[model samples]
Target: MISKVIAILLYLAVVMYLGYKGWKTTQRPTDYMLAGRRMSPWVMALSYGATFVSTSAIVGFGGAAGLFGFPLLWLTFLTIFVGVFIAMVGFGKRTRRMGLSLNSHTFPELLGRRYRSSFIQRFAGGIIFLFIPIYAAAVLIGISRILEISLGVPYEAALVFMTLLLAAYVITGGLKAVMYTDAFQALIMGMMMLMLLGGTYYMLGGVTEAHSTLASMAHLMPSKLQLGGMEGWTQGARFGTPLWLVIYTTIVYGVGIGVLAQPQLAVRFMTVHSDRELNRAVLVGGIFIPIMTGVAFTVGALSNAVFMEKFGKISIAMAAGNMDKIIPLYIEKIMPPWFAGLFLLGMFAAAMSTLSSQYHVGGTSLSRDIWENIKGREASVAASRFGVAATVLAALIWAWVLPPSVIARATAFFFGLCAASFLPAYLLGLYWKRMTKGAAVISMVGGFATSMFWLLFVHLKEAKVIGLSKALFGVDSLASLAPKGSAMWLMQWVDPNVIALPVAMLLAVGAAYATQTMQREHVELCFENIR
Candidate 1:
């Protein structure tokens, strides 16, 4: 107990110290907004990677892997390739050059200036304001959940704890603090996962033994384990039918690709000192994301072997279901108390690093995007800080009371929304010459509406009112037909990302062309930024 307290206190001190240091260096909007455009590529890479892998990945995804099995492992590869790869090759250099030229301080500013439309800025900000809080809440809820389960802290207290800690650094130092601390947290997180992975492996008697052991157990290995197991087409056909495949594909590749266009991330491209730094970030980000994400997948699955060998019962809640907790659970069992405390701190690291960015981005959107749009530019720094604090507070409170079922899905929903609303317009705005102002709006509206439609009426649990076994299915009321089933029968292709994103893309292009001849000054301005 004393060790745990010590660990927590020590962590708080280090986190605060870092925030204090960053705050000491920051003075103006440029430092707060873009870190003075001088961040190292490696630092940028770590911060980005750390930001992406939040408590949602640790807890919600950990739980997801537990419930869904291994097919989602595809996310590890997709994150590295699309998240980092496309960011560098497709969007990074151009964004950096363009942002620097325009003196843009925020994502919407860049997009707005690029397109020369305050309308686009308003549109983007509105979407971010509407959706990002849900995702931010998911991160907070996930962190609080872990604290509630692991340390026996009260949920509300845990939420408050997370809120206060994140708020201190972000309000004081802004993006500079976020990046510095993110890099440090990323290093700790990387080490902690490595330790957890090693510990799980050593405890479970290594791979050959684990496989041999799982081979003998019931449901340990999926039925098709031998035939490339679930690694085959099972995910796309079975779990990922029309409804989920779209979700899965869109969530994985769609969101991943969309990273290239993110205002928060795009700012990083512009902030770095040189193209050389961005190139170096690619190597650091590419290698690090997989190591961390792959560890989550591997440890999540391996939990089965660990549990069967030790207790003869299944308990994957730590990993969410499969073995997400394989890391946490392993730390509790194998490491000494002090080391366990240290290892668990890694969870704290993941939770804080990711949450800080979300809060920062969301707050920036609120202050810069919404406030600036309505009040005009020249919103004060004090106003920005106040916005950041309020955004964090609002999200923290909401996380405490969110419905149990909704908590896990919140991050996915935001990712889905972003994919729907931003991905189509953002992507085309960067790469497609034919992309018009009308088209961007159409894509944004179409994707946004379709994704929401799929989530609320078409794909919800209510839709499953009628099931194969009458008792098992629940019926949905809002659709053309009252759909019902145990997912297998219908509503399977309900993943908003797959369905909504493509629709948005199609609409954006069509709309852009439909109004092609009606060229606006704003639209022409965007083309000039990149050129």
Candidate 2:
């Protein structure tokens, strides 16, 4: 216990030093928001990767992997190919160039400036400021679970402690602090993940042996999951079943494609100097993302095998049905005692790295994007700092109220919401001069409304929890009104992104054609300096 405390203190001391460095260096709004647009490629890559793959990815989604098994690995493929490769190479350069040209500090500001619409910026920022806390709660739950299991800390105490600790640096030092700390945290996460993978495989025998053992445990799957369409840990989920739709549509497809439009992740592109920096960061991101996500999913599934071998139960069963607890319980029960402390530190890094960015973005959205736009002037740094504190408080409240096993679902909900709300306009704004302000406005509003409506009334996971549909129509989801085992009933399992994104894209295209184009001069300004 003493050694763990010492390790934590030392880790925090280093993090504070980095935070102090960022505080000392920040002399302007650009420095606070964009790191003066001169951050190193390596720092940017690690920060971006770390911020992208939070404790939610490792602990929350990893726990989901424990339930769903190897099919979750498909998400790893998307993290590498789409999240890193396409994000950095295809979208990064364009976003960076355009952000630079327009002097946009936040994601919403980028859209607002590109289309010359303050309303667009304010609306996007409003969505982020409000919905981001739910996502932040997912990450908070992940690390709090780790602390609760590993260090025997009370979950509520851990939540409050982490929220206050993060607010200290993030509220004061801004994006530079977030990125510098993220890079440091990324290194810790990478080393710990590598160790975890190796340790898990070694405990279960060689890689082939581990997989084969897990594969052989197929028939041991819970009857509930089997009925929901799950096949086994090694074999993928059965096609077109309820579990299949949840895994593929919500977890795999929703999060996979939704990553492209994450405000926190997208803003990182603006922190670098040039397209070359983005290109160089791509390789680092490519390597880092696969290691982080791949190991988590692999170990998560293999944990089922390990638990069944030792405790005579599956991973979820061992966790007592709370998927959020699976990874933490596995680490506490299966791994070496010493490893528990290190893994806790890694999770702290993961959670804080992501949360810092989320808070920073959330704060800026409030101060720079929404409030300033409302006031018709630039918001002071003090206001932005206060915004960060407010955001931290909001997230803490959400963490307290959110249910168990909600980490992965909350994350996917936020991701799908952002993709539906922002992707259509943001993507088209970067490349298509014909995309008008009217189209961007309509698409953003239309997408956000559609996504929320579906979440409240149609998507079973959320509708059941929120009880809005139940209150309004006496059903958990509107889809529940359909005949049992009918095609319409399956709509309850389908992710909002599967339905909302295409509708948003169509709205964006149709609205663009129906509206007049932006001024030629402004369009040229947005595209200037592009190669």
Candidate 3:
């Protein structure tokens, strides 16, 4: 524990100092929000990867591995193939040129200018303000969990400390700080995990023994561990997490493809001086993301070998509703105190790297996108600073109210929401000449509503406002069919993305097409920027 405390403190000092250095570079809104438009390709790629991986990849997705098994590896492929490769060659260069041409600051600004629709700016900005919290809160949840496990801190206190630390660099230096610290933080994440690879193998006897034990656990998957124990299990199996095709294409692909639409990430394009730099960054991102997320996912999943071998069962939760503790629990038990400290620092890097990006994004969405847009010009310093304060305060309030149990799904919920709401419109506006302002708005609205309805009414909602089986068909839920068989019934399954996203896309395109004839100005503006 002493070692863990020292590790975190040292890591924090280094990160905060980097933040201080970044602060020296900010003199204008562009510098604060877009790093003075002078970032190199390596910084750009690391910044993109930092926000992409985050605490979600570690605590949330890592726990998913412990829960689901090995198929989630599909994300690594989608992330690399679609996210980095396509973004650098196709989206990144185009967006950088187009954004400079339009002098756009935020994503919605670019879209609004491109499509000649003020509504797109406001609507996308609103979504950024709203759905982004779920993702940000997920980072807080992961950070809180790690802190609690390592230092015996309460989840609430851990959350406060973590969120505050994140807000420090974010509110002060904005994008410059986020990118610089992400570069540094990404490095920490890599080093710590590299160290853990050694510690993990030594503890588990070796790589061969580790795989043997995990295989044994796969065989021993208790009924509780199968596809029907949790309410989600049956649904996951019914549609198979939809990943055989949909998850990779929609949820994962949507994210990789959707990076173009991400306001915070898109802003990175505006900062780099040249397309050549963006191309250089792609190589960096390719090397980094695979190491950080790929390594964590592998170790977190394979650690189950040690888990089952030692405890006779794999338990991701050290306690009820405390999923964040899973990785920390395994690390503390499986590694020496000093190594556990390093692991904790790595975990902190994962959280901070993502949190800093979120704070930068949230503050800019509120300040630059929303506040400045309505006035028809740039915002005042007081206004930007006020936005910074409000963003931090809002995150702090959420951290205070968040319960342990709600954290995990909230993380997934946010990512899915982003994919649904922004991906279609942003991508179309970028790549499709015919993509109209009408189409952009329709897609955003459709994706947002579909994802929300699913989470509240179908997936996470306990009340079952309209029974899934009954709503889609005449059959009842699994509860109704339980007596007839083992209750892993067909109608029992519900995949929210499958149900919601497609509906939203259909709504978006249909509405846009119907309205396109009247919105030529909007369509022309989008056309001017798309290439």
Lowest summed lDDT across 10 adjacent residues in model 1 is found at 226-235
Query: What ranges in model 2 sit over 4 Å off?
Result: none
Q: Write the per-residue lDDT of candidate 3 for residues 73-133, one digit (tens) a residue.
A: 6667767876678766777777877777778877777777877778878888778876677
In candidate 2, the residue pairs with backbone N, CA or C atoms under 3 Å apart (3 or more residues apart, or in different chains) clash, namely none
**Model 3, residue pairs in steric clash:** 114-525, 114-526, 442-508
Taking all chains together, the TM-score of candidate 2 against the true structure is 0.99
Q: Write the per-residue lDDT of candidate 1 for residues 226-336, one digit (tens) a residue.
A: 222233212322553443454365445545555554555666787797778889999998988887877776665556556656666544533343333444454465456
Q: What is the TM-score of each candidate against the true structure?
A: 0.87, 0.99, 0.87
Q: Looking at model 2, which ten-residue stretch has the lowest summed lDDT?
A: 26-35
lDDT of 3 at 122: 81
RMSD of 2: 0.8
Model 1: lDDT to the true structure: 0.69
Better of 2 and 3 by TM-score: 2
Candidate structures ordered by lDDT, highest first: 2, 1, 3
Q: What lDDT does the true structure give each of the candidates?
A: 0.69, 0.93, 0.68
Q: Which is the leading candidate under lDDT?
A: 2
